[model samples]
Target: MKTTSITHRLADLGGAKWDLHTAARDRSDRGEDIVEMTIGEPDVALPEPLARAATRAIEAGRTQYSNGRGENGLRDALAESYSARRGRCFERDNVLCFPGTQTALYAVMQGVAETGDEVLVGDPLYATYEGVIRATGADMVPVPLKAEHGFRMQADDIAQRITERTRAILLNTPHNPTGAILRPAELEAIAEIALKHDLWLISDEVYEDLVFEGNSFTSPLTLEQIADRTIAVSSISKSHAAPGMRSGWAIGPRGFMDALLPVSETMLFGNQPFIADVTEEAVRAGSTVADGMRQRFAKRAQYLADRLEAETVLRVHRPEAGMFALVDVSPLGMDCDAFAWALLENAGVAVMPGSSFGAHLQNWVRLALTVEDAAMTKAVDRISEFARSVAVAAQ
Candidate 1:
């Protein structure tokens, strides 16, 4: 059989998931016990109610297909939560359920952007957003967010990048790799740019609940005007430590959502019915479980930050919220990739290179502070020792 020709866009999308695999392989080859702080995978147990809900769903034979949009119960639950948090009235028709936020984000980009169109992405982003935009043959225009700015994207920076080809702006609150939470004023500025340029705002709020230090999470959906142009994407993966559940939803204007339904129909046909059934239970009872997980992550983040403060070589950009610390190791003067590899080999520590987030930050590394406090403390000690040795070698 003749092989089908792969598109050029697919060529640009490979190796996105290689960081974790590389860390795992390096640890195995060295016969070392690695404390993984690379991926944002929470090392917490799944909420007890999630398992019960899943068991009941499976017993009820909900293993079929759900509506392409989503089951009404799950949609209602999501909408209710949206209303409670953002004070926005969302209807079941305004939501679409998918396997996870990844699929939901891809579908939204596919729906709104055409080939060669441009998406304004904040640098040091979630990493996968580039792949999603590239897969659609759209230009990923990265606007850098400096560590000096707490990795927050300013509105003026976004405005300078806007052009006729720009179709959307991707926003991640309590952003991954940095934990940069866009405050209300910063979000307002971005919203104004979106409104002025007529750009769609793709708001990724998966980490909204995991905020720390009493930082408030402000959503674009809170603005009545932007609600029509905003696509608010969230998932159960991070909030309840239920990544196994693989359920998420996109809440936005009905018109924009309708555009994405065709993409969903072509890709997933419909979301998993069983997962949707369990998702209803999660959404309804998520308040307590989600809050508990946030508190645990807050404790872990604090422990890691406190340890980082004692290290002379690395500087941690302590975020007011979220599960990560964007650590700058420029004082040691090694590229992030090399630093990460050396740490893995010598200290048995695994971390993500800031280069994974964007090209401008070659000297920065990202540490996921979501692991258990004990594991994180040990990892910090390993990193500090590694930094000291590097310092001595330089002299």
Candidate 2:
């Protein structure tokens, strides 16, 4: 009578990362007035057309299970979208639909790496990345994303870390937790390393639509040389503000997609047809909410950075894209965990400690940029005052 080793592998991944956020929740449950800024839940609501599409599908009796690779129409729409953006032709066979990016990444990890292998991902990544890699019985190798570089994962850093055991390089751009987008040249460099090492390049591009005016996103799938080695996963969760729909897909070489088909079937043979129809319509119509999120996120992030810099000892690493703002709390004379807890208890604001992402981020803390101006201003006001007290006491 025994559970499996994989259970032990992933048992440590889920609960503890959200300790501060959990504590914040408990305090708020006790009738406390708490301003929660830890989770990256999109503040925006789903657009009318998308919602109508879902309703229409349900009325049309489109609630059955989809095919193993998803409905042909949705896959075709996804292939067309990526083909237009990447300048590389894609077909339905190259796209495999999943419930969301989390599931897509999990299947891709199982397809690309396995027991005793390694997958290189940027440190201070989205917290669930390690869990997915570990679930496949592979080790997630960390390549530090330095603050000096805006926390963008460096090509050289990734290159230096690749070993013979390395089976793939997992990329998230525009990255989560830090909102650092990789440049086209940097992606080309990474493709070269993958080519030289014969490794898979698995990209998480869920934040692709959120790039601001001055920034752009490039996927490794664009490189002709590594065409067969690249796999990308994304969802309408952020782009369309459609997280509850749980619709996403993976695009990769035909062979990889072919190999992953049975795995997708065994796990969850199909997505909800009604949701797939809605996702297809979304892909065809394109993202309507991304621009609004980009504008609001940029504006709020800049205001937070400016206020922190002018009024307190904390510094924000300005982001190029995506929704979260990374603030360096090292000047508070305490680590991010200590600073975050005290800020929550004393100021009624809750943000995640850097340790939730990785050790490299321990001196920093992350707050969601989805809050409105008034609430953001209030949170920063409390943060500034709390910071001043710490600074004065340290002096």
Candidate 3:
């Protein structure tokens, strides 16, 4: 019997990061002490009020299917929150909720882009973006973010890559892997380019609430001119530490959102009612919980940066906003994949290789700040030792 072949688009999709994660888990299951700093998951729990709200909704029989767009009250709450943040009038019609931010992003891509179109993406982006774009039958045009520019995506670079077939620009602030936050000027520049090119701007602001001191988050929707073309996606998964709840949303112009509703409905008939309840409570409670998490993450980021700087040969690019540090490990005379896998196997510490993010990052590795202080310290010590060993071997 012959089996059906998998689609080419998905064949080469997942990154080595998942393989490392599985290896780490296997090591732990076998009683090996492994320090995991690979995945960008917060070592925090859901806020008490939000969790209670979810429980209440479940007990109250709010488990039935909700409106395809989302729960009415939840959509209103998200719209109000975004309206306050973006300084614009956003109603329920402008917001669409989903089980996860990933789905929301997919819906936006599917809504705005068609087969054979091109979407510009910043290099060293969140790993999933590439797969999501390709899965939509669209090609991802990478716009490199140089380390010299502090990994910030430049508008001029994006402009140089735009073609008649380009349909959208995927922007992530407080970006994953590098933790580079886009400044207001940069946002303005990109928004202008998008406006001039008549391209949709898909802004992934999932890390918006995770910014540190002196760095801030800006949304393209804040620009009045591009508001109609921007789809700002975010969630409580990272900020509220409720990844398991799978609650997220996309806010955009009414017309675009109306177009997205059918796609969202076909993909996820509706969000889980209990999760929607939790998300509504979380949103209405405002950013207090997220603010607290941000403060903690800032301190942890500094701690890890200091450790890597002092002990390892890796050149650490300390994050300004998100919970990750992109460290260049070229000095160790090994590419990122080799360095990461060898360190995990020999030192029992796991981190994501830069190659997992993109080709331009082959010499770097990403350290997540989600590990606890004690575990992070241990991991750093092991990483330092591994770096020293590599340096000696290269001599």
lDDT, each prediction: 0.82, 0.92, 0.86
lDDT order of candidates, top first: 2, 3, 1
Least accurate 10 contiguous residues by lDDT in model 3: 1-10
Off by over 4 Å in 2: none
Q: Pick the candidate with the highest TM-score.
A: 2
Q: Which runs of model 1 end up more than 4 angstroms from their true locations?
A: 1-6, 29-31
**Clash number for candidate 1:** 0
Model 2 residue 98 CA deviation in Å? 0.3
lDDT of 3 by residue, 1-395 (tens): 65433267767876454788788889989999999888887777777888788889999999998888998989999988888988989999999998788988988899887788999999988989987798788999999999999999999899899999999999998798898988899999998898888999999998888889888788888999898898988898888888888899999999998888889889888888888888888898865467776777788777777877787777888788877887788888889888889999999998888888888899898888888878877988888888888888888
Alpha-carbon runs more than 4 Å astray in model 3? 1-6, 15-17
Q: How many clashes in each structure?
A: 0, 0, 0
Tens digits of per-residue lDDT for model 1, 1-395: 65433356666556754665475667667776888887777667787777887888889998887778988889998889888888877888899999899988988888878787999999988878887888777889999897678788999889888889999999998788787888789988898999998899999999987887567888888988787899988898887788878899899999878878888889888887778978888788864466666776677766666676676567777766666777778888898888888888788888888888888678888887767778877898999889889989999
Question: TM-score of model 1 relative to the true fold?
Answer: 0.95
Candidate 2, 75-143: lDDT as tens digits: 999999999999999999999999999999999999999999999999998999999999988899999
